[model samples]
Structure formats: C-alpha cells, structure tokens
Target: MWKSRKSLVELSGNLRLIVSHARYGKANFHGSNTHPHNRIYIVEKTKSPDKSYIANLSASPGQKVILRPGHVYFMPKDQTVEWNFTPGVTFVAFHFGLEIFRGIDLFDGDSEFIERPVSEDFTREARELMESSDDLGHAVRLHGMIYSLSGMFTDKTMKAVEQARELMREYAPIIHYIEEKCDAQTTVAELVDHFGMTRNSLSKGFAQTVGVPLKTFMTRCLLRKVTQQLLTTGLDSKQIAEELGFSSEYYFCRFFKKHTGMTPKAYRSDILH
Candidate 1:
C-alpha cells in the first residue's frame, strides 16, 4: 500500500468510477448483460459456493475457483461474464470506463479474469475507508486498492478461456461480419441468406458456442452500442434509434428502458452527473 494519504483527485481525473458493496448467498448465476465497463471486485467474507454464485467468461469449461477471503478479481470491459454471486459472500465491486486507464495499463485490458491475493487485514481496512471517504477521497482509496493488486499484473497470474475461441472458429468470419454490420439495417433473414444456412442453424450454432442465442446476442450488441451513444453523443433519442435500425423511436425508447432501468435521457443525465 502506498503510505502517503494523498488526494485521489489527481489519479482519477475524468474517471467515472462507482463502487458497490454487497452480500449474497444461495444466488442463481444470472448471466451478465455485459457492458463496456471494466470492473474490479475484492472479497471480504468468502463462503460456500453451493450458495455462492460464481461465473465469468474466463472460467474454463467445468473450471471453477474456490473463493477465499482476501482475494481480488478483475473483469475486463465488454467481456461476456456472469456478475451473479452466492449467499454469505461479502464483496465490494468497482466499475469504470476502460478508457480511464487506457494509458496506464495497470490492469490487463484484454483478459477476462485476473485474481490476486491480498491480506485480509488490508482488504477490510480499505473497504471501510473507501466507504467513508468523500467522493474524491473515495476514488483515491479505490486507486490505492488497485495498486495493491499491481503485482498480479506484473506476474501475469490470470486465467482466461484461451481455448474457447478455437471452438467457435467456424463462426469467426461470420461473427466478425455481424459485429461490423451490427448497426447496419441487417436482419437475421438477411444473415441466413448471406451464410446459406437456416435460421435455426445460425442461431443455434451461435448459442452453442457463444452461450447466447444469435438474435439475443445481436440485440445486446446493438443495445450496448446505443448505450455508448446515450452516454457520449448529443443525438436525440429518435435520431439515435433510427440510426441503430429500430422500427421507430418509440420502440427504441421501450427497448432501451427494458435493457437499462432508465429511459435514454435519464440514463444520459445520470452518467453525466
């Protein structure tokens, strides 16, 4: 830990950082509606996995980790990971835009799972101080917490699904095309024609490998793109909706509110604030 209790304001310029303190057990592992935020989680009270929800994009097939107190985990932005947690687990999670650290490279920007060991004493103290600190001070504390795990970054002690890509090798070109045309006025029927496959074949094939139905995956991608615009662009809802290929602005608002708890304008306000 850095000994100086310096102001965190300097380290956190233009950083949109938020922290969540939570306890969970006996929780079903709901898949994440993955977003563009990179995340950091630190364990406070590690308990049973039977009730402890543990899921991530990096966990290998049938691979799982035994949660231990004093461990910290990192999730890269835009990865399809599970955010659910099991019961009796106390943890603090931090989420921020990846671009905030784009120049620093403190954490792995590409890996899905990064774990590091910290002393339980330090973890508990950091959590308490982080919760009590004022906005700027709180950010500094979080930055310090990240620094404690810096050794893991230097050591490369991360476990990612290195082989998962090989399994979906067949859909490599198709997936790339879909992503590039994600906002294009494209439909599944058109996709089927382009690939010379039936709807079920493409959808099922993608689900088999991507863990999400094809249409659902595409919808999530579109919504994520819309979210970025909502946060960063000045385009009105109607214009943004049409650009993303929605049937109408009304439908776009409903879909946006469904995926995100707030309407587009509200979401933008909250983020900007």
Candidate 2:
C-alpha cells in the first residue's frame, strides 16, 4: 500500500515542495550502499566526467552521452550505486519519494536508468528556483518547474491521444446538438449544415480519424449519457428510455444489453457493488 504521509526528507519545510541542490567535489565514497528512504532522484548535469554504477551496469560521460546544459537523469530507488565525480563536477539533485513519479513509467524493470538533456531555459529556471534560501518559496517554484518538465515528457507520449481528442472535439458540437434535438426528430441532413461536409465526406473523415462510424459513435454517446443517468439518478427504465429518445423501454433494454451484455439494472448494481 502507498503511504499517505511523505517522509521527513520528502517534505519541504514551509515550502510544500521537496527540492535540493548540491555540488560534489572529487570523491569516491561508499557507506551503507542501501537505498535511501527517498525513491526518486532528478540529477541535472552542470559538469561531467562523472561515473555512476547501478547494479551491474556503469554509465560515464563520454560513452552513450549527449551533453546539453539542461541534461537530466531520473533514478529510482532501491538501487545500489557508486558515484565517481570527476573533480569539481557541479550538479543539482532533487530527491523525492517514488510517489511523485507514479504517473511516469520511466523504467522497465526493478532498476533502470534515464539520461536526457533538458532545455536551456528550463535548466536556468530550475537552477534559479533552487538558489532561493526561502524553503517554502523554493518548493513551490521548483514544483511548478518540475511539473512543467514532466508535462513536456507527457505531451510526447500523448501526442496521438491529443490528436484523436481534437478530432472528437471538432465533431462533438454537431453530435451534441443532434443528441439535444433527438426528441424533436433531427436527421443526418442537419449535420451537413453544422460540419460543412457532404454525407460521404463526413462519414469517411469520422471513420478514418475518429476510428468509428458516425452512427456507431452517436450510439456510444447516447448510451454513455444513459449509463451516467442510470448510475446517478433514481429514474426507472421506462423514464430513462423516453429521456434518451428510445421508442420503448424494451427497445432500450435490448440496446443496452447488446452493447454492454448486461441489463441496465444489472449494470447499475455492478457499479454500486
């Protein structure tokens, strides 16, 4: 189970954010070699020729390295390693618990490594935030910067998700308008005016981009609304059927069963349970 309270090292005093910056001199030291209580490490390289050993793998500056000022590495916890800092190598390290990185899957196994250079502007902002002596202020600023950096990474992964959602948004207004006017007898002809496309063109575009036929998508939207109403409200089957533009309660039950393999009452009970 995940802990609700963060450890002392994970909490920022008065800042509500935990961030630390350190510079290492030429040193080779090994103590407990056990993973510290903290689980995440954000190491930004200011100077290099540093060597890090984790498990059986070792990483150095020259090999498999692309140096940019804003370079960052995310190291997770429970891994043992030795650090050999080439004399006078300066860097900033942020130590936090694994919970902060819960949404990010940076590693593939029990232990993993990540090294990437950050943008110059981002690096400068992080450095300035770290320089603040005010713990609370520093935490807030650092939190924002780290979040921004994390968002940058997330945006890369979600590029396809965003594109799909954008297409959905473009057609959503028309779909919503049709749904609203369903009781008043809306037709596909009305959608042409809203989307400015012929029937074939619109169908093709929606299928190719949205990955669903127009009719099927509309059915999904209507069913989703019906499900929401069923789960949240005390309306009965017949009332919901009329509200959702179904001809009869029996028809609505069949439609719901076909799509979900369960009757409305059964679905609701499953959700509540």
For candidate 1, write residues 1-273 as lDDT tens digits: 667634345343523333322222222243444444565667777456544444565445523445566877776654556545655667666554422221112332365476778787877775786457358876676666655554354443222222443466687777767757887367889889998999998888878876657776567567657876776678999999888888898988898776655678876654444
Candidate No. with top lDDT: 1
- Residue 150, model 2: lDDT of 39
Candidate 2 ranges beyond 4 A from true positions: 1-156, 162-172, 175-189, 193-196
Error of 2 at 13 (Å): 29
| TM-score result, candidate 2 | 0.39
Cand. 1 Cα-lDDT: 0.60
TM-score to native of every candidate shown: 0.49, 0.39
- Model 2: per-residue lDDT, tens digit, 56-103? 132333123222334665554324444343433344555432222211
Clashes of each: 9, 3
lDDT to native, each model: 0.60, 0.49
Where is model 1 poorest over a 10-residue stretch in terms of lDDT?
98-107
Lowest summed lDDT window (length 10), candidate 2? 99-108
- Taking every candidate in turn, the Cα RMSD to the unseen true structure, in Å, is 11.0, 19.3
